[model samples]
Target: MFSKSSNETKIAVLEERLTSYEIMIKKIDEAIQIMGKTSQTISKMLAVHEEKLDNTHKNDELIIDRIKTMESKNTEEHHRVIERFEFIDSKINDRIEILDKKVDEVTKFRWLILGGVMIISFIFSQSSMVVDILTPDTDNVRIEKPR
Candidate 1:
């Protein structure tokens, strides 16, 4: 009877330990399920961030393209303006050359007229001296009364 009672006590302790192990396993399963849900939520948030980053990158590319296009247009306009300025400068230079030639002609004509006037004045003075010598001196003649 003593042996039978010891065996019954051992069996009861083992059954209690099995029930505790089962309870621990159930809690672990619940924790695993919560962790899986949290992991799924984090993955969704990361996907949304990636999409936003891609959109931003695309917008930056578009802005760069627009800037490049504007730069190209500005370069073409600059070249055109330079060409126009060169043409204007050439025209101005040609006009200045023409004006210089006209001034030279006018100066030459003035010198010629001055030389002609000097010669004419000298000839007129010489002719007046000759006429005075040829004319008889009237101051030297004395008046004679009739005898």
Candidate 2:
């Protein structure tokens, strides 16, 4: 009877150890499933992030292209405005030259008219004095009225 009890005790201890190993194996499987889920989630998030990065890169390229186009257009417009200003400058210079010639001609004509007036007065007048401020010179002049 003592030998039979010892055998039964050994069997019980073996069964308990087996049960503990089984439970440990189950826990390991659950942990492996959780790790797989976590890895899958990380992979999905990484893919989304890569897609967003690509979109942002494309948008940046588009913005750069637009800026280049605007700069080219601005340069062309600047060139056009410069040419127009040059043309206007030349026209204004030409107008100034014409006005200068006209003013010279008017001044010369005015001087000529003044000289003609002085010569006519000297030839037709009896007195040589041009402008008398105080009184008129009547020393050698005589005037009579017939009635």
What TM-score should be assigned to candidate 2? 0.70
TM-score of each: 0.62, 0.70
Cα lDDT, model 2, residue 37: 100
Model 1, C-alpha of 87: deviation from truth (Å): 1.9
* Candidate 2 worst ten-residue window by lDDT: 126-135
Candidate 2 wrongly placed segments (more than 4 Å): 1-7, 118-147
**Residues 1-147, candidate 1, lDDT per residue (tens digit)?**
569878888888888888998898899899888998998999998999999999999999999999999999999999999999999999999999999999999999999999999987777667967668766777776889999
Q: Candidate 1's C-alpha lDDT? A: 0.90
Lowest summed-lDDT stretch of 10 residues in model 1? 128-137
